[model samples]
Target: MIPVADAFRSGGAQPGQDALALTGFAAEGARAVFTVAGAEEGASGLTVHYRTQGEETATVTLLANGTEVERLALPGTAGAWDTLETGVPLRAGLNTVTLRTASGDNGAFELSGITVADAAPAPTRGAALPYTAYEAEAGTTDGTVIGPDRTYLTVPSEASGRQAVVLEETGSHVEFELTEPANALTLRHSIPDSADGTGIDATLSLYVNGEHHRDLELTSRHAWVYGEYPYTNNPAEGSPHRFFDESRVLLDEELPAGTVLRLQKDAEDTADSYTVDLLEAETAPGPGTMPDGFVDATERGVTPDDGSDDTAALNEALAQTSSEGLGLWLPPGDYHISDHVNLTGATLRGAGEWHTVLRGSDGLGGFFGRGGTSVVQDLTLDGGATVRDDAGDHAAFEGDFGSGSTLQNIWIEHSKVGLWIQSPTDGLLATGLRIRDTYADGVNLHRGTANTEVTHSSIRNTGDDGLAMWSESEAVSDSAFRFNTVQVPLLANAVGIYGGHANGVEDNVLADTVTSSAGIAISTRFSPVPFSGTTSVRRNTLLRTGGYEPNWDSAFGALWIYADTSDITAPVVVNDLEIVDSTYSGILVSWQRTVTELSVSDVEITGTGRFGIEINAAGSGTFSGVRVSGAAEGGLDLTGGFTVERGEGNSGW
Candidate 1:
């Protein structure tokens, strides 16, 4: 512990034997600098003891080695002294730490002292769902076994357990025995790419008990990125990689434990080679139903299963629903649309995602909602876009839900984005969504999207972040992403929060981030509005996440806090997290400018390619109950003038 008297005061800070009184902080840049000597190098905990009489929270900026690292919000103590803690990295020997008023209006407070302690320990939390993971290399295979290697950037990394089985010829097969009863199966595999780099489509035959079951269609259209970070699909730009995508299907009947399952490259399967990595089997929920009092779209001159455009008729049905206060329903069939269908305060229902299909051509079709309480459910939106176009609004679902909306049981694919909800929207409840093969984010609540929740959704094979909240023009506040499963995103984090207030990511499962990012990221990047209030990341599981960042030629962490763009002074809580099989670091805390007042607890990290926890920035945070094991580069790798104070109960360096 370092006493306040040891700190050098400036700009009206009065130092005492044990405390420092900071006054006239309403004046800009008033600060106190603390110089600590003989500190051990590594990640450590920093706790501030202070008291304030202000009615609102007081804001302070933390600087390490003259670079801003965090903005800390001090809760009003009502004249009573209280303590707040965060994690900090310190160098061996002398280190400089400074605290300043964030703004001219920052409330005054008296600091008692600060404590630097050892990194704490946390309890373990398991995966979110109950399922068995079967590695292809461990299964009985007639095919040749491939690598546990990741030396080339032109090849995709193995999915799980660091190995895969490659079926190079027809009739080659890999078989497995079910460990539990399962009705749904997800296969992680790779196939040859097209010469043009667009991708190729192939099929894999499934057999149950030596009897032919069905064929699963697999595509590499959304995988195999080339070039540098934020990769492109044009093969001419660079070498191709990220050579994997997943296909999922629900079985007609649940198979009991110990049932035999085999995936084979039949004669009809024309791919040059099939690389099978892993399989995930689970029981899926039943389908949903359309509510009563809904009018059928066919009655309003809409045609199903036709190749013609249905955009006009769809708009007519939706408009009628809005005017007459009726719900519109589309029966099970394929409907093609060439343009957008405007929806306002309407309820749109479909038979099911697999049954009711709305296909768009060359990034044209989609539903754009304006205002009022809209409801869209039980439908599949397929935007037939072959390439990415960031400047265009080519998402399957776009626009805003004025005050409230509900989107449930919808599947979206092959678009620039799945759901791009814009600014000023609120009270959105999105659940049971299956979003895949997108060119960008699966779901993004952008700019002033508040009081929204996206839960119980499956997002996979995205070209960018699977789920994100970007506070671009205005603050996105009080929103959440919970109980969702995200897998195999080709680029960027699975879940990201960029400058939001009181937002949270909880109880979600994230895995297999290909490159340039992590499983989950909280940052002040992209020049969004400054963060306010508290951000919570809790009870989430990350698997096989974190990979090489090509731009920086470094590795990211499974969960990363990047204070870049602006100062993050708001409080952040990361708790009950389980990170397993990280390609690099398990947890990383970095700062380009400033970040402060972060609390992480009850986090378990295992099998990191690099360190378990890597701190490469200047900031103050408190980490407790964090346990690490099987880190290749030891535990608590700290740099950039950071130090560690050893604690108890942390094991496996």
Candidate 2:
């Protein structure tokens, strides 16, 4: 056996030893050296209650044969030996389990009890995994799409079948809850523990209702950690809950209180012993307003019936409120306004994250060029369900106030159009907006706007493009579109991330698209051109293209763009950019007209069809770094497409 005590006493623990003692092993003046061992077994597992005497910081190790198997960190104390269960396989006959005071503080060590047995079989995996989905906080609930592990919930149904996902968190603790608690829910997060001073033996528990279901043992030495607890069952039965009640217990402690859940530790020294950190929960649809802190509007006498002549009272209150002002809550009932509901300086908040909804009725239609400079979150807006189908794409909320308006975590659906922003006062700062599930393009930039950004929001089940806009000076980056549904006639392009100018499309992925609509469709307008611009498309992934299903048409491009006028159809004028690893085609250059200059590189096409890289350079452009292999009938093809300069950098076509 490789005794820890012997190694330390032999001076092998250090490179040099004192003049009066042996070299290496010993620390000039360390107290004592001792050895502890237990029987060994093959396969299964072993449990041993190793006895330790006195108080001294020492190192203990479980050894198999003469080789080290498990390194253990032990505390120095004057108490009875504790039972330690080790799960590891050993050589068939007589494995040597060793323990030694790798340090000099020294104490006695002995095996109180040792037991070896065969290992149990692994648990079998379930036949099918649960599906999950998420709803857009910025638009209306058109259709709900469920994903694997039920991690994603599309449209939380008022009836059944689908559930809502929520993400909740504190500095060191996080909790994920769903709208329909009955559906299967998951709680996954990272916990960064920075405390090491005190001894800590933490037990992680998973509770169903008030009963304990699973328990995990966590050691303090493992400060940086990641853990996931999944609760699966039909929501119709009951939802999973992350229990953090002080009255909860996992393993029973033989104490007076009987079943107690607490941190137990045995420590020797207490120097700079401190640990303070947060457990962040990142499950979908948690219990909190959008973007963390948001106040309710109606609760502050700012509702539609707030005793003002029109929406003027609410509008006036906005200009005098803070950038982080209260939300413009509409409650769950109907609200009517004679004039436009302008919001500026304040916030248009909602009640209970996704519970409270604001519905417009009568002559009010829904909303107008309102909420100039406000932060909107966690509110559902069902504007004028009474309005006719074709209402000139009116909006539930419009960003006419330029710079100070920020919209995040809002669900606006069942409207002619979610938002029709005409550009507000501030050019670059006129963002922090999110347009989710609207009746039409969630938020149509509609010609006159610049400097807008959309991130981490869902735009699905829209009547038209999930989002589409155009402005010679506009750009869009870091946006996404996945499963937006359509019922009757069609739901068009799930996402139209296009504009006449430099529309920077990057880091976006779309899957299971069913329509002829482009996940991202953009086109150049020539009628009224701007001073300078070229569309820069890069870093996008498209999965399951083609709307052949009940959703959209199959001719969909995860990312697609074209020129408005036929005269400028070819792929020419596009400039310095990179399109890589897209769904069907890493970078699909779809242009009807000709261009001045274009370059395509490092593009990976995923799917089954034509060339990985297709240059529709009816105009004139460059194509390079094109990768195509997974699908594509041919590899590289050129119809109206071409390249004055083209070839491979990362092309695997």
Candidate 3:
């Protein structure tokens, strides 16, 4: 991927660090050229990230090596950055790719970046190949349509298409026709909770065509929360909210396109009501296999699927693998562990998340990585803990990895936390992680974690922040979170940066923050170290974020900048943000002491409950290319000592 600012341009294209703003299109021969170094290139896929507004679509001509390749129509995004992918021919070494206006109508747009790869990027482990999402409201339903609303905290507001179907009566159902062949399906739904607030188990029946296919077990145990920050499952403390959970299942046979899939609340179903949000269908890949030269854990007396304790055997296998300098492999079965397994300079592999299962009960313990390179992948960690245990060291995985270490394709559920990495670790890449139902933060880089990255992961139903970098003892710098989807965090922000430097949150989608904070937050609340370097928040989409803060008796913004504990004195850049259906303000800048040098550019705010941009800090900033619509309390409500040098193309104030 190459940023547009790094490319060579002509004909009045304004180049900036965040994007290339194309203007003066009436000029002759206006174009931008990119030099791409390809490795053995033949046929490659090209993806361009760009943003534009207005009703008219833009047209760009693509030329490779000075030859006309294709004319691409760039659709207007209503001011949000979107991607377009196409096939491009390339030579082995250096290739010059150029984009020029193909039509007389300029229809301005900003180019963010472009990526050229050998093919379309491969899907992460357990992700649906050729995935297609169908919204419940768009399907044929005999149920009640609940909302396009976001004000009610107890109802889920971050649903796709901003509305959902509620099946309140028995036999009420929603049906959708498959557009492609699929063998696996994932349903996002919410059901009424039990009166006592411990959650309830229910069932929903699936029908293929007119025949009964299967029954799905749905539970509210992983959803719903109440009370203050770092919330609780008990209802008496506060109003209940965060009302959604997901369930996935693989079919016995692949269904053909045009097959009618139906979800019905039949008489046998246990729930009083079922709220259907969305369904995703995909053709899933086959299970994984153990690689050669790896030591199988069964050889060390570890018996799987026997419902017996395998903790001792797994620990012995770990020690042997560490001593022999070999990787440990667990085959396709369930292994029960009652205590934590220590991993030192070890690699543990499993036969895919759908096959290998590590289950534990109340005394459930996690895997701890220490010393040299520790790699864990392709397994499910099921901490069968029913409730939050604040004092328990029950994270599914804890401690930091050595340089060049990774945790990949791992599924963690019902744990105190997931993948809590400690300080001083660098170059730890965590990708393809599915962490849900965690009592606390899903992934937390705690202090001094530098040059690490978390990408292509999914996290939901976390008690605290879904993904966070807390610079408590040492500044967590030079880390990044990109291309991840975080949804329905029951408390706090979806992504939180507490006093980090040179850290970036980019190309991520965050939605449905329940209470106490924003969707993406940059704050000085916990870190003791002074802020330094530039903090970047770019190209992120926030949906239905912001909720009431009980302690402050107020609400937050969808994207918040707050200096609570210390003055934020570093340059912060927020660019290419799209905030939709914000429950409160779209963007909030507040400080207790002082803040300086904030730059916000190329943002779109739609359907905000309060002001689009609310500033209450003692700071100066530059704002540009910001557009807001459907804000109830107007836009740009500036107060306090905050001053702005307003840049070009700002409206809706």
Best of the two (1, 3) by TM-score? 3
Global lDDT of each model? 0.77, 0.38, 0.78
- Model 3: per-residue Cα lDDT over 150-253, one tens digit each: 55464645454458899989899999999988898888899877878878999999999989999988988767777654566788888666677778787889
Question: Which 10 successive residues of model 2 have the least lDDT summed?
Answer: 122-131
Q: Against the correct fold, how does model 3 do in TM-score?
A: 0.79
Candidate 1: residue 547 Cα off by (Å): 2.2
lDDT of 3 at 502: 91
- Clash pairs of candidate 3? none
What RMSD does each model have against the real structure? 15.7, 24.4, 12.2
Residues 267-318 of candidate 2: C-alpha lDDT, one tens digit per residue:
3112122121111111122233332333344544555534344355555555
Q: Which stretches of candidate 3 lie above 4 Å from their native place?
A: 1-118, 121-130, 151-153, 157-162, 192-199, 224-238
lDDT of 3 at 546: 87
Best by TM-score: 3
lDDT of 1 by residue, 1-653 (tens): 56664454444455543435444444454566554432345666789888887657887888643345678888888888898888666543334566766564373677766776742221122223324779899999999887665444534353544478999888999999999888889788889878788899999999999999999999887567677654677888876766777677878999999999999999999899999988888654444344566788999989998788999999988998779978898888899988788878888888766568899987778988787778787788988876677776478888888654667668887788988887667766676687877878999999898877786678877878999999997999888887788877777899989998899898888887877779999988788887889999999999988878766787889999888898777998898999998989999888666557888788999899999999887767777788999999898888755444344545654
lDDT of 1: 0.77
